[model samples]
Target chain A: MTNTTHLIRDARILGGERADILLRGGRIEAIGPGLAADGAQVVDAAGAVALPGLVDLHTHLREPGREDAETVATGSRSAAMGGYTAVFAMANTDPVADTAGVVEQVWRLGREAGHCDVHPVGAVTRGLGGEHLAELGAMADSAAGVRVFSDDGMCVSDALLMRRALEYVKAFDGVVAQHAQEPRLTEGAQMNEGVVSDRLGLAGWPAVAEEAVIARDCLLAEHVGSRLHICHVSTKGSVQIIRWAKSRGCDVTAEVTPHHLLLTDDLAESYDPIYKVNPPLRTAEDVEALREGLADGTIDVVATDHAPHPSEAKETEWCHAAMGMLGLETALSVVQHTMVDTGLLDWAGVARRMSETPARIGRLTGQGRPLAVGEPANVTLYDTSAERVVDAAAMASKSMNSPFNGMTLPGRVAATFLRGVPTVLDGKIQ
Target chain B: MRHLLSAGDLTLDEATLVLDTAKELAQVGGRSVKKLPTLRGRTVVNLFYEDSTRTRISFEAAAKRMSADVINFSAKGSSVSKGESLKDTALTLQAMGADGVVIRHSASGAAHRLAEWVDGAVVNAGDGTHEHPTQALLDAYTIRERMGRLDGLRVAVVGDIRHSRVARSNVLLLNTLGAEVTLVAPPTLLPVSVRTWPCSVSYDLDEVLPKSDVVMMLRVQAERMNAAFFPTAREYSRRYGLDGDRFARMPDHAIVMHPGPMIRGMEISAEVADSPRSTIVEQVANGVSVRMAVLYLLLSGSGSGTGN
Candidate 1:
């Protein structure tokens, strides 16, 4: 492995002035123009784009009980394929990833998977029921060194619970990733509550249900003066609230998934289970607002709330099917399509949203570095101009549940390196 | 291998194949092992974006019995609540290597869209009120098991006709099976174009009851009540509810039915639901068989006409 390691040239190093990057002993040993290529196995990088390994703050590995959906190994492989070097695994698995033991189980599995650095996010409340706080210190002290905490599947609905979780994580400098949606307001909500709901005759999942929670959580974050990370921030109001919070200098950060940027509630008219998302796809205005947030940095990171389901659950009636789509395989391409191809933002923003900022938010220090010397060899090489249609059959995961099938994508991840090892090369998992 | 996304696309022969295969699956469902290797290596995802107890658990039990790896994905508990789009979740499921997806959504065409997006087969559980094709299949299965045939039998679907997916599907299916379909409901309960239906409309339930072979009642969704669709539940039930009086009015061979979780006295009297001529509980049991058939035929086997 050491003898086969080498250097790259003509790469657009994100955030780095130098175009050359040298890798030796799992870190960039040198990065400069016209560096010697002697005794090195060289990988040509003429006209290819390089980004710091991406980071995801919200992802469900579904281990402990639902490992069949995704274990750390499979999920890490997905992250690698999506050009992610680190991801904060959500805490809503069967056992909830609430306790130190469960979080440790997740940590060990990520280590065993070895495709990416899986940061275990301990639950804010035991079982994520929003009733009681979990042992934050114990999880942070565990081998995984959990730094990001969340009640992802469930919001810490109790105001006191949210406050307590925020203050508690302060001990470990942990950021509380909140899944915003008021518990009582959202029960039996099958679709986004508005014109679509009235038209479809299904119960409405009101946007206010999410926006209200974001508003409440922002206030709580401000009150406690503790860092808060909003997971999968949807809609214009939530973005506005987050923007206000950040302007007030409150320690609040937000993420918007790739789908929110590209799709909207019009698809709901189809009454298709494939478009039945949680915070159900909002209006086109919301999509535009999310795009603007992603472009101008109102949204801090682009995370794949990568959730997988068996085909049976997803195949049922619209009101009975699950509400998620697999995202890791197409996150970059989507960000590139909706943000870059449209020319709203440049490669620097792509690197920030996909790579650098997520690492900072999740506290993954070894990741999100410019491709250069003496930096941990975490890099994603891509062809910014490639065009290909996405097919679930060709993807690496066991599930073929992607919504991008047959849709042409203009961006592609060509190679990814994790600790100086090529986990992916030529668009194939190595 | 999983995810029943739509009813419109399935051929009649294909629909019957699922019904027949479900009959085979029912025999083995209660065996000591209570499992099969049919879907052992396969992964089935239960992706319900809406609130569902019968449909969700039915699919859950069906997949588990087939020995497929099952992942229960509840939207209430995922990032879906935040702002993650359905497509993102689909990509995530694809990345997890889901071989099959059983989905129920609130939207009308969600399942069809899913079929377009993924590699697995699509099964339309129900998309909006446009169709609940499987419910029709199951109801037909129950009718076939009891009435011996579908040709030329009179079946009256009563109450909340406009709001009931079950009614719409049953009407289409029963007429296809050669049954004389009559939709009995107040003018308010009928769709905007009830006149377009091949079936007859009866405002007089008592008049329609004596002539019918199957008096199927639809659950009156209370949520739709605010629209003044009907005068009141009491009035609606008095006119359309199946009680001993209505049961006695029907021909001796006529059976009563409802696609269930019946509102009890609201849809039918307790006695009628439990009557010899009533097939409500049998509907629940047949649901498994009907669903098993849908899964079996959709996943691997031929359509229902083949004896096998």
Candidate 2:
């Protein structure tokens, strides 16, 4: 093994003391004033803050199904590069992760790669069919130990089925992450239902379609007495529903993607598939509301929901292209831009939303831990001020499908420690 | 610059220039001996992948009227019937030494790809469910000719906007020309994202008729009605259709318009189609002149002139 005598010098240590962290044997040995290390390899943390490794609650590693898009190994590396210590991979693989065997396979692959922990999300139903329940307990007991369940690619449209799915996961405390789109309202849906769709002559995916589902699910969650997590909460109307639900003391949490906070449906005027995502990019007003929701904790976490696809799949016509974009590698930069750059969130807030709150929600133990003595050294050291235009080729994920390509973004990941092991160094996946 | 993809691609400045150029060409048509040498050294190909009569002939006339060498490429009873690909047809057109290509495909955005891949100027005659820029320009030209201007005019576009490419191009160009447009269609016919468009929208045509300086009725295309956007043809015509009774509510100077092949009993009544105020026929005659303007502005190589 390499010499592990590493010293971080002159840093505004995020956990508060004017300290130097000395590392050895893949663990933080000590951190205090004037911690001298003669044989230490030096790292200049000059003006940077040391935060815990970021983690994502939703990411799609389109492997074992559409490997031409993304794989668990590649996705894990992407998470690490993004300074994420762990990611909950969604359960919408080609065969669908409804069973224990498939999820365990994904888990095993993540372990083999060893970049970051890949917690495979189990499907709510067999093949996500929405008719019969899958082996939820078996998956929860499996090696993956999936705590999150979802039928993400399709909405669990049937009211009774949605209620049943929410109730079924109560024993495991698993969140039935609903896609929350009414299929009938959104059939042939191309973009946000507004004046732009009328002008563009494209079909509308209405705000109501998403709002209705989230409203119904929140009440169902209250009735079922189970936790529910709504994926990619995009609208102001949705925020109102979640806000009301929380006020009523219903156990529900919501997430908004980085794209939702930054980009709007106006970008669709170009008809670029890169901007074509599910719960399609909304208006600027929605962007503002979503950002406020995140900052105020109405929206609890910033999940990537990083769906990836091959170039060929996205290169077709707008109506015909695959729905998704690469977000894992760009999530941190987007968060930094939307929150920290705007001064809406400080570094600690970024840590809480991206790491701490997500960890709490996903029930990812040993994660989102503060940088303290005797704690697992899951840390992310970042250059919060450096800038780079993201190139898709440089992403660790297999699919080069990010919309943030050629986008100049501030903040860069310097290093990420997963279980005290440097899984990434200076933005390169280890 | 390479794809003439649609008349919608033309800015107001460009459309005005094209219209002015068309005025000169219309004067040439007025002469007993009608000809031009501007396109003598160029080649123009009309590639119609779908059914055509007016659009095809207008191009043949416009190209021949400009003295350009012309080729008519029809997909009917040809390899396209045998399911020849668009890329294959594009390659075939490239082989024929054509400098200008006018394509009318049933598929929308086909022209967009054609423009990207081809070396010559690609004009969108029409694609499946997209901007028919020339049809819109012609409609605009016919209005501007009779009304003397486009700015501040209240124009209502009524019919199946979800499937109509004509509606797409018109809203963009009309707004650009400083005309206020209100689209009147059932919620099914109107796209979900209509809120983003720059025009006012209404369900009732009678409500808009009093304010409109021009009421342009689009042809009700029956073959394109596939997923049941409206419950019945009669109901769609009843709520959103331009009939004589509905026409009675229009301003005294407000003109009725249709981009031909009108459904006499469906979208508009026979009385409204033949009304003295209806400029439906004027639109057909203006089509050749306006298309000539597009060909001239796009082909004449800085051959700038004034007729406006």
Model 2: how far is A298 from its true place, Å? 0.9
Worst ten in a row by lDDT for model 2 chain A: A9-18
Report the lDDT of model 2 for residue A14.
62
Which ranges of candidate 1 are over 4 A from the true structure? A2-4, A15-18, A269-272, B1-308
Q: Which whole-number lDDT from 0 to 100 does residue B15 have in model 1? A: 56
Worst 10 residues of 1 chain A by lDDT: A193-202
lDDT assessment of candidate 2 = 0.83
Q: lDDT per residue, candidate 2, A9-98, as tens digits? A: 765566344577776665677777677877887766765668887889899987679888888888888899989989998999988998
Question: Using Cα atoms with residue i matched to residue i, what is each candidate's TM-score against the true structure?
Answer: 0.64, 0.88
Query: What lDDT would each prediction earn against the true structure?
Result: 0.79, 0.83
Fnat per candidate = 0.24, 0.31
Question: Can you list each candidate's DockQ?
Answer: 0.12, 0.35
- Residues A138-164 of candidate 1 have per-residue lDDT tens digits of 999998889998888778889888898
